[model samples]
Target: MAEAFKFELVSPERLLVSEEVAQVVVPGSEGQFTMLKGHAPFMTTMRPGVIEVTGQSGTVSRIFVRGGFADASPAGLTVLAEMAVPVQDLKAEQIAREIKNAEEDVADAGSDETKRVAQEKLDQLREVQAALGAPAAH
Candidate 1:
């Protein structure tokens, strides 16, 4: 059996999860990485993606995060997210709506820089939608 470590998931609104976990997969800006007990200490900014958490009992929970930061230390792993929601709680309609809104933001951008940023956001939203198996926005 894998050793368990403390894990916490925090959003701006509230603490989402705090418990012992066997493993956690984080979506870092550079790439995805997994955390386990006795992991080397490090911190990395996250991208828009899903975080997969494995509990001591082997149950897996997935949380979708818009953006965030993750830290792995001797103490444990902590994720501070800009926005986080349980994958089970997310609906297809909600993802579609977000994608539509992101597309509109891209279209409404007035400057080249603004357009690029908006496009990046739109791309990320589409990726999330695909990951969730949500229908494409109308």
Candidate 2:
């Protein structure tokens, strides 16, 4: 039987998930990474993307996380996402609206730093939209 490890997914608003999972895939700032039972202890910054968790119950779930931190240890993994939502809960229209707002912000930002920040937000929004099965924005 495959080994299982404790996995917790948390957001500012609430604890999204807490269970024994066979494996989990996280989107690290450097790149995508996976965690399984007995993984070496480490901590890394996370990026905006989908987190995939395969639970002991044989169910797979996905969460859209917008930046945070992930801590992995031999005993378990903990994810502290700045914001997270179940894939099913994502709305295409909402994402599209956010993208539009970000684009407007990018256009109106006065300082270079502000523009850069807006661009990053737009990129993250696009990533979420893509993960939600929406076609890429032109």
lDDT of 1 by residue, 1-138 (tens): 689999999999999999999999998988899999999999999988899999999999999988889999999999999889999999888778777877898899999999997887778888989988888887
lDDT of 2: 0.87
Report lDDT (CA) for all predictions: 0.91, 0.87
After aligning candidate 1 to the native by TM-score, how far in Å is the CA of 78 from where it should be? Answer: 0.7
RMSD each, Å: 1.7, 2.5
Prediction 1 global C-alpha lDDT = 0.91
Superposed by TM-score, candidate 1 places the C-alpha of residue 28 at a distance from the truth, in angstroms, of 1.1
Best lDDT goes to which candidate?
1
lDDT of 2 by residue, 1-138 (tens): 459999999999999898889999999878899898999999999877899998887788988887899999877999999889887887777667768888999999999999998898788779778767876555
TM-score of each: 0.88, 0.82
Q: Cα miss at 51, model 1 (Å)?
A: 0.7
Instruction: Name the candidate that leads on TM-score.
Output: 1
Error of 2 at 28 (Å): 0.9
